[model samples]
Target: MNFDDLRTGSAVHQFPGVLLGHNVRIFHPHLVNLYGCAIGDDSRIGTFVEVQKGAVIGARCKVSSHSFICEGVHIDDEVFIGHGVMFTNDARPRATNDDGSPQSEADWKVELTRVKRRASIGSNATVVCGVTIGEGALVGAGAVVTRDVPDFSIVAGVPARVIGDTRQPVSKAELTA
Candidate 1:
């Protein structure tokens, strides 16, 4: 669908400031909240997804439904973000400051999170801020990532630990005879 067609009623909100590259498909556009973000060409954003301001999604990425891509999050090309994935941009989050005042943008710094090229984050994963999920890494389902995942590694569980490596070639001996 054309980007102009996305400009519909109040139910769907795709701000004019959002920079969408060629052939970017937002499935169920009326169910998504995207603003001030840059989605590269051939990317598909699923329903119930909210891509916040300053978030950059690279080419050929698939962001599944019920996912939240907060500010300062950069998803590289060919990344697959599974359903119900949550990305945090703050190492410490508080609604109010010590002075008993409501916290504003200036109150805290946004920590950047990067999901490198070809990384696949599984469903219900919680990716903490200031972590770089290295290239071709596989984050297992329900993992809570708190640190940098090495390249071509597979991580699972809370505070995600490296369980395997993706670059390892499958041996015939390990398979059925």
Candidate 2:
């Protein structure tokens, strides 16, 4: 392998002490800024993934390409964030304030969004602020999550209504298999 011929992107650390756990891989790191974020062990962040300030990603999580994880977002262990998934911190986003000035951080509240352990958010899903995606819940592709999802449930559509329950009664053989 020729060193000069190899193509690689830089991982720009804007903030000091950004804790990255063991065996973590960030691809095309130069395309985004990872500031004040903590990524856990065995995690993989794909190209164009922007993990903003104060965002916490747990162990063994996979955040795909072009995903925006803003502040006040907490993703638990084993979570899957698909490509193009966007998370909003402000419920009501405004460009300017009442006095015709640009809205700063103090102008609005930053709502918290939590994705519980083992939850999977599909591609192009938009997660609104102040919502908790329950454990093992699956948000379908292009779904807009607006509220708290129940545990082990499958949610889809514009408002992300519960489509089905993942917890089904199973036999001993099924569990063993």
How would you encode candidate 1's per-residue C-alpha lDDT over 2-46 as one tens digit per residue?
Answer: 334322223224455687877778888878899888887788999
**Ten residues in sequence with the least summed lDDT for candidate 1:** 1-10
* lDDT at 56, model 1: 89
RMSD of 2: 8.3
lDDT of each: 0.87, 0.84
What's model 2's overall lDDT? 0.84
Error of 1 at 99 (Å): 1.3
Per-model TM values vs. the true structure: 0.87, 0.85
Instruction: Judge candidate 1 at residue 48 and give its lDDT.
Output: 97
Q: In candidate 1, which residue ranges exceed 4 Å CA deviation?
A: 1-13, 169-177
